[model samples]
Target: MKKAKITAYVDAALFDEIDALAARRRVPKTQIIEAALASFLSPDSAEQSEAAIVRRLDRLTRSLERLERDQEITTEALALFVRFWLTTTPPLPDDTYLAAKAKGKERYGGFVETLARRLGKGTTLMKELPLDLPGSTDPR
Candidate 1:
């Protein structure tokens, strides 16, 4: 290899990064600078860069689809639970209504605390159940 020494001026921040990369990779700063310049100047890099971008976008699209599906599942579950609750809950008589309301409030506070603890612990019922279970129509 006929290597000739050349001097070039680089910004201090860029120089620091080059030095850091060289140190981390256990390579000379010249090699890092050469690799960077080669990547910058190569015609093939454009196509390669575009391919990399397309792959990333594909991954992001899949992630977004999964998010949408999850949201749909969550919305459906909440709606069904609310509907069932509304239909099943009987109206309380006026005499015991205040006591019932107090007890309901206490139970609700406990429910909220439990929910917060479960969320903080990252426990989710969705993850425990199989995908097929959610879509099943049969009661059995």
Candidate 2:
């Protein structure tokens, strides 16, 4: 492989950490940088990009926390709306009936059937997920 040198500025603490990592791993900074770049560029090199991964994970954690807070606020608003609507509006068709008859029942039914089929596999996804209580031991 060809080698080239490039200079760039970085935060002191972060550069120190990077240098420490290189020293501990007994690898050069260039090797670490190259491997990182390769992982970022490669389709199947996830294990090699620890720094990028930590950065991405930190970003995702922050975004997810914001989203979770937003979700809680949205859920509170929705619950309040539901309470107000239940008291004020004429509630004939409830959500369950409305959902069943929304012409989307077929889509939901298909999803249910797909789950049943996957559960039939036994040793696949269902093995890793929580099982229904008492299990499906009935022969009926």
Candidate 3:
């Protein structure tokens, strides 16, 4: 195919980038410029670009939704635990308070160790529970 020559002015920085890209690809500067121009002038370029953006946005939306669901689960779990603890735990007498505190600290350490081991083993409560719980049909 025959090619025509044309001259146009561009920013020095832009020209430098083109030069670098052409050198890196081991292609002629004219080839790089021609490919760029072809891409820019293609009728479907905008549509293709928009479609790619929409795909990315869709993926991001799904990710955000998952994060939101996880947050809700975490909040619900915490709230339920707090409510249960408040209702079930009896206030300790003054004489036994210090002993209870010491025992609580020891229990907490054991809990941490158990949690670390569970996490290391990649075992999660979420994995144990069914996504569709019995007696619950609500979908969020």
Candidate 4:
């Protein structure tokens, strides 16, 4: 049933608080007042309870954190899997490392260009890591 609007005078402090809440939410003051009345009169107040909303937000935050952690773990697992495949996986005598190298090049051809961009360098299609390491000197 549509109800007519009735004006009731509230205390100055309470009216100011309602105005502040309206400004904070960027909504008209009338809508906020109507929402408060509806919430109070609605049968399933528990569904719109502030406590339930807080719980849902907290749960979502935990879920996001878990996903970030799982992604890191998955990244580590992929790295370890790659290392194991390159080092320990036995290959056919007929199959040479050149074929594997070619496959790798085809798969991750843009890896170097992406790395350079991520390191704050301008994107270059062809890139070579210029690193001088000690103890193992093999210049190829």
Best by lDDT: 3
10 residues in a row with least lDDT, candidate 3: 131-140
Candidate 4, which segments miss by more than 4 Å at Cα?
A: 1-48, 95-140
Mark the 10 consecutive residues where model 2 has the least summed lDDT: 124-133
Clashes within 3 Å, all models in order: 0, 0, 0, 0
Candidate that would win on TM-score: 3
lDDT tens digits, residue span 4-106, model 2: 8888898999789889999999999888877877878896665547778989999999989867866775688689999998899664566567765665678
Per-residue lDDT tens digits for candidate 4, residues 1-140, read: 68688899999999999999999999999899999999888878876587789999999999898678667756886899999899997775656778878878976868766776767765322222212334544322
How far in Å is the alpha carbon of 9 misplaced in model 1?
11
Overall local distance difference test of candidate 4: 0.76
The candidates, ranked best first by TM-score, are: 3, 1, 4, 2
lDDT of each: 0.87, 0.74, 0.90, 0.76
TM-score of decoy 3:
0.68
Provide the lDDT at 63 for model 2: 86
- Best of the two (1, 4) by TM-score: 1
